[model samples]
Target: MPHSHQNRIQAPQLAAVVVACIALFTDMLVYGILIPLLPLMPAVSRSGPAATGLLFAAYAGMMIIVTPLAGRFVDRRGPRGPLLAALLGLGMACLLFAVGGPYWLLLVSRLLQGAAAGLGWVASLALIAAAIPLPKRGTYLGIAMSMVSLGTLAGPPLAGWLAREYGHAAPFVFATVVLLIDGALRIAFVRPVPPQADDPATALDVLRVKGAWPVVILIAVGSGVTSMIEPILPVQLHEALGLDSVQIGLLFGLLVIVAATLNPLVGAALGRCSPRFLVFCGVLLAMAGLLLLGGGARHAPVIAGVVILGAAIAFLVAPASTLIGVVGARTSPPALGGAYSLYNLAYAAGLV
Candidate 1:
């Protein structure tokens, strides 16, 4: 009877984890799907590099503004409502991208996508924390993070291939289908999990937790440094190595593949190791990789640098997220949503 009872309890938790992972995966997949196609946009092609940069910036900028507000909403309400809204927003964004139009439409699509990303990430992470037990949260979060990396790894190449064979609209069409499926899953499987009874912490209150600032800083710096690579690396690879779009996609995919493979190990380590220590090591690794990349005019060196940086990101992301979740639960359980919001906001700021 006890075993059966335990199984019943575990079932909902498992379902919640699955739903959260899918939501995050869908969000990242759509984000990455656009990377290869961005340059091909009519406006971008005509306007040159500056326009491309602006489109990317628009997404990150919106995320920075909306994330904290989304977090507060999640804390006050629950993850279910915010998550559903995010999914709807993502669908709209994908539709706009598929329709393809004036430069303004592209910008609007990106902005909406950014808002969805901000809300989706915070709500999904908060839901995971609510569903899973603290001791096991790191492992599950790691798995979910891996889904994110995998989405990034798969998206560009898949989109590139689809665009090459079918048309520009193909990837967006597929994304819309995937989003619909994700919405159906959420509607069916996700339930409203209430916040803890403790008073909800304001953004300021959440940031006041001991050890929060350092992690927030690390999140920002790590995100900022890595964000620099996406825009710069493709151009560099094209100019220096004469790589085509497919090759560039492959290279970017390889980096995320390494990160996806290592994230679970890093997640497992969170249970046993000091989160701060892991973060410090990750920073050193990223620095080393950056130094190596500076010397990477050649292929071998570039691949090595990318692999090292991928591992570094894996180390930083999972541990930092686990630490934040643990800290929120301890300091003010109802504030977990706000805490994740701040973390993501820092990440967006880094991109800006």
Candidate 2:
């Protein structure tokens, strides 16, 4: 019995979660790192805002089409194979970005990278849900999202520093190296499992589970509200407070740090509190934070608002993810892939 217990403790589950975390962290890191480097790319520099706007559109466009497909594929197959493939695709995208490109190739790179990101999000969440039991997914998913926030926090600054010190290609080269390591980790940690028996069930089937739509909507709201903040905050802070880049970065930096710290706690909180209660609390906090930012004349309120907003996000994301996993696990034969693919769509819809 003790030996059996040891086997359970040493099961590949946590390794799977670790791989998922690494994949997400790397995906977001490269994504964050690219922000500073893109404008410096020859094609973007020549074309300016129009080209930059196109790249943004291209990423959203690809996510709309690719993320759901990736999720569906994961349902038919399994997370291991798809996760590795997505990492490889992400590496290639980094390579393309690293080498610099004509406008068209950069667009292709954005599209490929977006698709790979979609794949990574789906596969990682599915991987975690697959490896973790129902009661524990909340905490793990929270930890996973924390890594995401951390990636975003680190990406732009790191890219800026690297570019200033080394060259334009340095950021991508660094990202490529990281992806290779993530890929290798995937190979070692994610055991090759044969595909599951084909489920006739579609994504719709997963949604049909009672109360699924509410959680899905929560996901969309959680993702959308958070995303809608990114583009607007810098401009708002600049105009309202006359803050420079460093000040604005500091504000967002605080937000990310707070969110990262709170995410795991919210997940762990699930054992005691309900998802609805947590989300309700998140909504209230979001409204309060927005009010603080919108009306504040001084630094303290703005800073307070950012931190509160970060906490709100932690409350929103962890519960919604845990609920999604719960419902996804309910489907006959358990189509976590389909469930999380729908999650991708909600997330993308929110993002776009």
Candidate 3:
């Protein structure tokens, strides 16, 4: 790297990367911590499938309302302020679960958490786009994705062990502490970068841009395919395929591992290619996975489908964010925030 380029990269930017990675990790960890424990929830286990589905919906419902607003807040106020506030909210939300609060409390915490999550994710992405040069953005995004993948991969086993040894609440406590620490580090190390967009108010206007809609469609479909697996896998494996929890865990773990390992390489490759091509290939791969999943085959087929899906995610997510960044470059900071917020909304919606 040239001296000027090296000089442009400061400790704060590096810290922003670390903070974003850790924030992503903690977010995934907190969310996945409940997976092993959810079956233990009285409502989930005893209630009918319809009721249980409602409970799940209740938890995720807030994301729908909070994401776009978070982006606007980041655009107007900058990342450092909102990021810290969001992290603190996440920490408190996790702590609420740790104390074994009532279902109502959990519901409230989840809603608050959805807002925090939207802001945290948007802020982190915005920070990355502002701190890193465009040419290197894909690689950084890949690294960020892998960090999140690693967290999701690691969270289950850790939470499972905690639940088994200590109790369900133990994992929540751990998540709270991790999030707090992450927040503190972010506060200490990260500085707000100048806004990247020209106008937040008009950023949504870009939705009319002929090219942007394809990216949105791509995000929605890709996210939906990924979301489908989480709900179906355990039942399909246990009921249809006759695998035990241990086996299911191993297979799922492998998917995260593979995805994490591949994401950076995929991102670097994306840097060398057009975002559109990479995203298209990602969709094709995910579609293949979905086909295998719905085909109702044995364990091998299931695992194959999962691997493909993970690979598709590894390919698609960073490029999608990159596309948003590209689109926002012509707009104002608030518009940039709106664009990212829209991306998060698409992602969260897809997950639903």
Candidate 4:
């Protein structure tokens, strides 16, 4: 399009995007990587359902507690310290996964990982918001989302394969090594962004900002709409179509693949389209998908619903996020961090 827009991704901005992508990818990667490997572990399997459930709670609970605080921290101090913490937290969690045997150790690892994930998401988004031109942030954020989708799509099967080929520790070892590279890139490419907030002291202050609540609600509903389906889609397919676990997993993978493929394109469209219009279209699509998801008794319709919903989510998430970034950036950079912290909380709430 415009030469000015093309020139937006200068070295620091490019590095910002790169590090953000890797940070998000690693955060999500750690999340997905353990999915298959954990159940296969004798200790984990023997731990029973209560303990297994607690394992997930460890991460999600910590994420919920830390997200808003991390947002405030990033806004005040900039993304530098939070980014470093992400690296260290993720690294240590991976190390524990690789070597530590007891359930307590694994539980602690999840806690560390959950906290790190909160830091990574807030810091990385703030980093890009600060580094990239406002006009281009949507597109770059979409690219980061695409990387996150890759981590989600790849993590389960990759870990399963690695564990099968080598041992239970293989996937964790690989993740630890990936974190090392992530560390190097962080040191080399992460530029410090000065704090920009003038009045907002906490994420709560973000509520006082005009035009912020709608974006926050949109993020939560848009994310929740898709996420709430994750557990249901598999079960619905199984009961209605008699699909096996493998087939259901693959069907769900289609949802991830569709969203992953479309997110960047949707993100780019934000530069040219009204964020409001894009979000409206996304809502319409989501409604249609929900109908199909609810009405369908046949396999084809359900599968189609999954694909459509995936695209609907891509459309919904990108524009809303871009708008929120705009809102956060209206005055100072700290607001941006606060906004994304709200984003993380909203996303986490959706997961719950």
Instruction: Please list the C-alpha lDDT of all candidates, in the order they appear.
Output: 0.79, 0.76, 0.69, 0.74
Which candidate comes out best when scored by TM-score?
1
Report the C-alpha displacement of residue 140, candidate 1, in angstroms.
3.7
Could you give candidate 1's per-residue lDDT for residues 118-156 as a string of tens digits?
A: 889878987887786554655686677778777888888
List candidate 4 segments past 4 Å from native.
Answer: 1-9, 39-41, 47-51, 99-101, 196-206, 209-215, 222-252, 262-312, 315-319, 322-337
Per-residue lDDT of candidate 2, residues 1-352 (tens digit): 8655543524578888889998989988987776546655668667765567677657767878877787677766778877887888888888888778898888899899888888788778777766765446556876787787778888866776677678878889999889889988998888754333433355678998988899888888877666555545555665678775445655666777887788779989999998779999999999999898878778889999989998998899878877787787788767665666677777777666
lDDT order of candidates, top first: 1, 2, 4, 3
Candidate 2 vs candidate 3, TM-score winner:
3
The alpha-carbon RMSD values of the candidates against the true structure, listed in the order shown, are 3.4, 4.3, 4.0, 5.1
- Tens digits of per-residue lDDT for model 3, 1-352: 5955754756767788888888877887776665445544554445544544454455455666766676677767777887887888888888776765565666666667776777778778777766766556546765776676777787766776776678768788888778768877987877867765434343366565557777777677766665556545655666688764445556667767766677667657876898778888887998897788778568778888878888888677757666765665544332454565567777777766
lDDT of model 1 at position 142:
62
* Cα-lDDT of candidate 4: 0.74
Name the regions of candidate 3 deviating beyond 4 angstroms: 1-7, 55-60, 99-103, 129-142, 191-206, 235-248, 261-288, 291-298, 312-322, 325-339
Clash number for candidate 2? 0
- By lDDT, the best candidate is 1
Counting clashing residue pairs in each candidate, in order, gives 0, 0, 9, 0
Angstrom error at residue 112, model 1: 0.6
